[model samples]
Target: MRTVDEIFNEALTLPNASRVLLVEKLVESLDFDEDITHIDEAIQELWIEEAQKRIDEIRSGAVKAIPGEEALAQVRRLLEL
Candidate 1:
């Protein structure tokens, strides 16, 4: 397995947009267990549960939503674009 630095260095060599897409594909293709075929389904269910939890938190005023434009601008700044 590659170390984090090695992986990051490799990722950095990819074009910016390609790196983002590659990361998205890598995340989507992650396998939790070689012995478990249902791992992706399990992860999907967990994500749904976590999303619902966040929704509940927002409903209860425990979390605040950021505006879409503001979030986009922040990301643009972070990426220096």
Candidate 2:
């Protein structure tokens, strides 16, 4: 059987339209619980709200922004990697 990385690399080479159809078919195959739609909506809404709060905090100088590379380095240190 083809490994996941092999399958993924093959998928990446498809035209954009075909790649979209492939993704739709793959998601359909998962056949998630009917309640997953509602759960996904709630999760997305929470993330949107969280993003807005962060934006407001940064604008108000309540929080300072750091470079993404610096943040990633801090995370790697905390994880001891």
Candidate 3:
């Protein structure tokens, strides 16, 4: 079995989407075992709704749009990806 450090080090080299998937799987493993699946699903749904709302707002000009590159850069900066 891989040590946590080994897994994490390898995870660090993954693409952003892959890293997110890995993290989600790890989080769900811990959370599901503890029976927090409902809470987890609720939070995930909330974020999806929020993101969709933001997209709609942007499309309607209710919110300003950022360049995709700029948004990606900000996410990478925040995540240290």
Candidate 4:
């Protein structure tokens, strides 16, 4: 029998579309006795949407941006650097 790593390596060689389908099947196979909670799924979706909105705002310059060095310096100051 093929080891898990060998199976994973073989799966990696599949085309993108095929790989996506295989992944979906693999995830579905994990649902044995426990069914997914709808509320948890909805909360996860909301978090994804909120993150996308924040990313869009930053990209569109709607939110003020800080330089990485400045942010790091502020963090270091908070840590008593």
Candidate 5:
């Protein structure tokens, strides 16, 4: 019954690559478990809020959007496709 912060702190102490792998596994396994629905809902709400903040930044000219071609090229390079 560890708190999220405690779990996160423990994960943070892992090596950088292992921490990333742990996060990836956690994300992949995040199915709709009935016991953790409330926690999942809170996480989703935070994601929405962060997305809204990014949108607001773009609207306020605080962040610039990448051009489509440049973005596509970067994606292709990352995917090695």
Candidate 6:
């Protein structure tokens, strides 16, 4: 049988969508509170919609994209103040 660490390492190699699906399924399996599950699902849907909007904006050139390092540097500067 595969160890948990081995399975986790393999899961890390999956594409982002696959990883998200895997995580959702794992979380759902452990979720005992129906109310919390519903809330989590709603939040996930909102995030999915937001992410799609951002991707569309980037593709349409409606907004400029910044490099990751530059964005992180800006966040660090804000936190340091």
lDDT values for all models = 0.84, 0.87, 0.86, 0.83, 0.84, 0.86
Per-residue lDDT tens digits for candidate 5, residues 7-75, read 989987877667667878988896765589788799999999999998999999999989999998886
Q: Highest lDDT: give the candidate number.
A: 2
RMSD of each: 5.2, 11.5, 8.0, 14.7, 5.4, 13.4
Whole-structure CA lDDT of model 6: 0.86
- Candidate 3 regions with alpha-carbon error over 4 angstroms: 1-32, 74-81
Error of 5 at 61 (Å): 0.5
- The RMSD (Cα, Å) of candidate 6 is 13.4
lDDT of 2 by residue, 1-81 (tens): 999999999998887667777998998898675569888899999999999999999999999999999998886665452
Candidate 2 Cα lDDT to native: 0.87
Write down the TM-score for model 6: 0.55
Query: For model 1, how does the per-residue alpha-carbon lDDT over 1-81 read when each residue is reduced to its tens digit?
Result: 889999899889876667878888998997655766477689899999999998999999999989999999887775553
Clashing pairs in 3: none
- The TM-scores, one per candidate, come to 0.49, 0.57, 0.43, 0.41, 0.49, 0.55
Model 2 poorest 10 in a row by lDDT:
72-81
Q: Which regions of candidate 2 fall more than 4 Å away from where they truly are?
A: 1-34
- TM accuracy, model 1: 0.49
Write the number of the candidate with greater lDDT, choosing between 1 and 4.
1
In candidate 4, what are the lDDT values of residues 16-71, reduced to their tens digit? 66777798999788855676688679989999999999899999999977899999
Model with the higher TM-score, candidate 1 or 4: 1
Candidate 4: misplaced stretches above 4 Å? 32-81
